[model samples]
Target: MDPLYLGAIVAIATILVLFSGVSVGLGLLIVSGGFLVIFDGMRSLELMPEILFGKLDNFALLSIPMFIIMGSSISSTRAGADLYEALERWLTRIPGGLVISNLGACALFAAMSGSSPATCAAIGKMGIPEMRKRGYPDGVAAGSIAAGGTLGILIPPSVTMIVYGIATETSIGRLFLAGVIPGLLLVGLFMAWSLYATWKSGDPNLLNGRSYTWRERFEVLPRVLPFLAIILGVLYAMYGGIATPSETAAVGALLCLIIAVVIYKLWHPRDLWVVLRDSTRESVMILFIIAAAGVFSYMLSSLYITQSIAEWIGTLEVNRWVLMGAVNVFLLIAGFFLPPVAVILMAAPILLPIIITAGFDPIWFAVILTINMEIGLISPPVGLNLYVISGIAPDISLKTILLGSLPYVACMVLAIVLLCLFPGLATWLPDAVMGARL
Candidate 1:
């Protein structure tokens, strides 16, 4: 069979398998391995160890676990709770303050945790309940944080960006820098939606925010500032050429542990055990997907399917914007079914070459792709953040969470359009700070 037709069939099969409730990593491995054996016999299967295991041997990949630990350890503490309190204290005077406050805390917590579900679980546990207490509607209260949680992958020190960097051989530092402006842009868009929602409802409770003393506001800072500083330190170390991402991740992870122990008194063996256990589980899951993706990519490359597809796309005479739209639609569909990390690992290799060939900046596209993933986090089927929100606030039906999150989904879609109009939103900082890629 021609590689093109076979590739299309394989793609359809992969999606079907995923929808059947198989674990993503395992599903990829099974489908890829089976197809490879059938494609070229058992001899081809022997190379799996060299192709897959060798991919796992990357040194930069070490940063993944460290970053996971940074998020996990901090999450085990009262940090998310305190971060929400800090933002809540200040934003409470405004209409829809609770909603805005949750989004603000989510952005900050995303910086610290770099995991979407973790951000949602940590913040929603506290923020959602409070928003309900303030008489905020279900959709606005649960939906806001559910959408906000998607920030984890776009913020600095994001594991998803790191995965993309490693897969494409792009600079990790540049990817991190690339995400900063766009991440903030998404935050702004989310808040604007919150404010607009507040206005639309004309609910007095949204306006009647509780006042906080300056002392209460100042005190929450001590607990939250350290995590913020850790994020800044990681960004600077990587951008300023002071430390490698792995080294930065290592230091950030250590600081998170120290703060969790000293400030939050997370020193008990049971607490530490839970942190390690959860981090390990999440990290292993991500790494397994990456390894599976490596094998899948290898299958395509070995058979020339990926190159053939890219060449076909590149040869098309269609306008570049139309091509980008097609690519974004495909990414959005993939994101709806898969977690961001899995999507990045599976798609980046094939897409990066085509993106460069089309004269698009890979880093800018990374931001656009992350925004698409943000939508997926709120969208149905595999919308992980929606489930996270539903788990935390069981009273809020899935339909309510999905409906509330729709506007934020529109906000993310608008973000992608904006980044398309002004690519600088994703590129300016990286080019200015590190100089543009040749």
Candidate 2:
């Protein structure tokens, strides 16, 4: 049996199973196991343990749970409300002020927690209702938080970056630094678009927000200082060589607990248990997907499928720019149906090599991939963030949320193009800061 034929069959089977409503992890495992048995017999079954363990046996991968826990702990506290309140006071005077404040809160939350859904849940719970009560459009309010929540994966402490780095053997620290600029760029673009949208819609309520006095703005500062300190501390420790990515994660988690218990005093003893339980559940789901994707990835390598595809791509003689554009388009389409992690897990093995061969920097490609995942998180059909926002604001129709996300999705696509054109946007900071270390 030809490998290409087998690969074709596996691809078709995955689509069928996934579309049939099987979960992504189970679907991948089922398809991969079937192909493995057919091609390599029962002897290959024994290698499953090794493949699973090998994938999980990474120091950087440990950070996923830690980051998730920190985010969960924060969500369990009043920090989300505090962060939104603080930002709202300062931002309301600007056009589309509430929306801008929501984006700002989402960015700050993303920096603390690397999970997209977590960011959406925290800020959307607070922002959406407040925006709605202020007479903001439901779609626009929900969309702002949905799209902004994607920053959880693009900003530092991003689980997506950690997974990508561990899977590809890229430097996790450098990947973290690389995301900083692009993340800031996306934040700016999203806010700018929100202002334009508000202005164009001629919604006076959205634009004519009250301004906070300097004293009022400073009064809310204490509410956010604790989380802000931890974020800065983690980045500084990592960049200063005081800690590895995994260690930074550990420290961040500890600091979040301290802030929750000591400073905020908002976390009850029972809340700690809940946070742990929820974080563990989310982490297990992610690891299960990683394990499944690992086996699938191994099967791709053993069958030489990825190499064959890369070779075929090389022979096309297409300009690198054209190939890059095509790859972005394909990823954008894939984002609509698949969760970001699964997309990276399954596609990175096949796509990263091709991008590297085409003279693109892997770190830069990592940023580009992260941004693409951001767009997918809000896309329709199966965008996880859209559902997250919907879950938080049950009254906000899914259609309204999706409609609002379209503009932010456009902003994400623009950010991707900008990163592609000026690779330095993603690479320059890491190059300068990490220098020889990177």
Candidate 3:
């Protein structure tokens, strides 16, 4: 059978099964199993267990659960509300102050936590009500949290980056450094849009914010100081060659546990138990999808589908920039349905070679791709962050949140353009700090 025709049939079948409401992990497993039986014979089933186990047995991959636990420890405690209070005190004097504070707070939290939904759940639990109390529009309040939460994947220590690096054999440390500038750029863009929208709304109600006294602002710092120290410590330890990414995660997780128990008084056995249980559940789910993706990728390799696709792309007559633009547009559309991890698993294998052939730096492209995934998290309909915020604040309609998030989406698009035009935005820091990659 022709590989192209077989690939089409497999793709269509997978889509049909996914649309039928099966869970993503189950859907992927089912589709991959079918492909194995049909394309490689039933004998291929014998290697399935080994393949799945091999996928999860990586040193860097271990960092995932540790980071999740660290994030969950903060989430399960009062750190989120305290962080919000600290930012709110400083940001409220300006128009759209609460909304700006929400964005800032999410960015800060993203530095500590690497998952989008985790960031949303932690901060949205406190940010939404405060925004409502400040007289901001419903759409803007929900939209900012949803959009800001997407930063979790773009910032350093991102789980998505870890998956991408392992999948494509890119350096995880370089990928972390690569994301820093673009992530900060998105932060600036989101804040700018928040300021503009608030001013344009012309709501006198929004102008009624009361500023915190200087002493009050200083007092709230201790609440967030420990978390901030963890973020800096992890990043520095990784960058300074003091520890590997996985080791840094372990140390960070240990410190977070200490803070939760010692400072937050979560010393009760039940409280500690809940954090471990919840973090483990979330970690297992993610690692399972990753394992399933590995088996599926092997099947794609067996059929030579990835190579065929890359070859077909290489034959195109268009310029590299034009091809990249088309790829970005396709990813944006695909983001509407697929989550970032699945998207990276399915597309990175096929796309990375074509990108390398075009003479683009893989680390730089990693940053660009990470930014696209950031936008995906906030895209309407199936964007995970949108549903997450809605769950947190049931009163806000999905449509209102989607509409409010559109402006931040534009900000993300601008960041993509800037990164594309000047690749250094993603590459320079990693090169300057880490020295040139071989």
Question: Which candidate has the top score in lDDT?
Answer: 1
TM-score of each: 0.97, 0.94, 0.95
Model 1: per-residue Cα lDDT over 1-438, one tens digit each: 888898898888888887888888888888888888987899988888787788899999999999999999988888999999998998888777788889999999988898888899999999999888877778888888998899989988899899998888888889998998989988999999888887777777776588999998898899889888888888888878898999989998999899899999998999999999998998899888888899988887877888888889888998999989999999999988888888898888778888988889999999898889888888988798999999999989999999999999988888899899999989999999998777
- Please report, in order, the local distance difference test score of every candidate based on alpha carbons: 0.88, 0.85, 0.85
- Which stretches in model 1 have alpha-carbon errors above 4 Å? none
- Candidate 2, residues 1-438, lDDT tens digits: the string is 566676687778888988899888888888887778887897988998798778887777888999898888788777878899998998888778888889999999888877678778888888888888888777778888998888988898888888888778899989999999999999999889877876777768888687778999989888798888988998999999998888998989988988888867755778788989999998998898898899999988887887888887888889999999988888888888888888888888889889988988989999888888788889877789888888998887888888989988889889987887788999899989989542
What's the CA RMSD for each of the models? 1.4, 1.9, 1.8
Error of 3 at 58 (Å): 1.1
Worst 10 residues of 2 by lDDT: 1-10
Q: List candidate 3 stretches off by more than 4 Å.
A: 204-208
TM value for model 2: 0.94
Count of clashing residue pairs in every prediction:
0, 0, 0
Which structure among the candidates has the greatest TM-score?
1
Cα lDDT for residue 206, candidate 2? 80
Q: lDDT value for candidate 1?
A: 0.88
**lDDT, ranked from best to worst:** 1, 2, 3
Q: After superposition, how far is residue 396 of candidate 2 from its true place, in Å?
A: 3.8
Selected candidate, larger TM-score, 1 vs 3: 1
